[model samples]
Target: MKTVISLLFIFMVIVGCNSTKNVVTTDTVSKISDTVKIANEELEYEVIIIDPGFSSWIAGRALPRGYYSEAYLENKNQFYVAEWNNRVAQPMQYDSNLYLFRIDYDLTIRYGYEVNYLIYNYFIYFQNRYNQRLGGFVPKQ
Candidate 1:
């Protein structure tokens, strides 16, 4: 009887601990999602503010095959996040889920000026590195 009582107490304690841990984990995940959403919104707003015609250009473009890999885009995005923070004087976070690569792919396809891969990368690298200032100056075709 004593053994049964001790076992029951231990089980209850374990279950209680697990439930609390789960709650904490869930809360953390929710907060993270919220932060991501806000950051994505801010990113979108900044991009539009800097390049008002970008959306229209993107709508008319198609993504090219082998033009960019997921891994490469992700690395660029991470670098962009760091550069953006330096430009904006705030730590702007980013996630791969933000669809930045998709936007880039579309923009690459819609680029009006004749450009090869090398020229295109230089243009985009400067645009992003400068937080769209270079992009705004470049006349879109």
Candidate 2:
């Protein structure tokens, strides 16, 4: 019994030490279906997460009816995934496979970065593929 208890205690200590506590606000929780608020400890800017299910969908779903090749979509998806992972201080803390399921058309775009254009285009592609009329903001390419 003592040996078992010691092993359990050590396991808990290891798990506890590896975990990170995130204090999410009510606003973030309410808008979770539409936006993702990832706290980047290293970066100065906040990433306005629009789609939470993008990574998983990309991993699981087929490519939408479009002129873009499967390789193109796959490459783009990989780019976004890698970029997002690099953005976060602890990549393992968040579920990289998750993507937003709903759309909030009311949220205005702010803190616009050039990379957002790429992300937005991918969002538009996702919307088109899933037939989800989300954020109607389409990209030219």
lDDT values for all models: 0.28, 0.35
Model 1 lDDT tens row, 13-44: 00111111111111111112101111122112
Query: Over the stretch 43-85, how does candidate 2's per-residue lDDT look in tens digits?
Result: 2223344444543443345343454654454445445444333
Off by over 4 Å in 2: 1-64, 90-141
Error of 1 at 25 (Å): 20
Best by lDDT: 2
Highest-scoring model, TM-score: 1
In candidate 2, which residue pairs get closer than 3 Å at backbone N, Cα or C atoms, i.e. clash?
51-100, 52-98, 52-99, 52-100, 53-98, 53-99, 53-100, 54-99
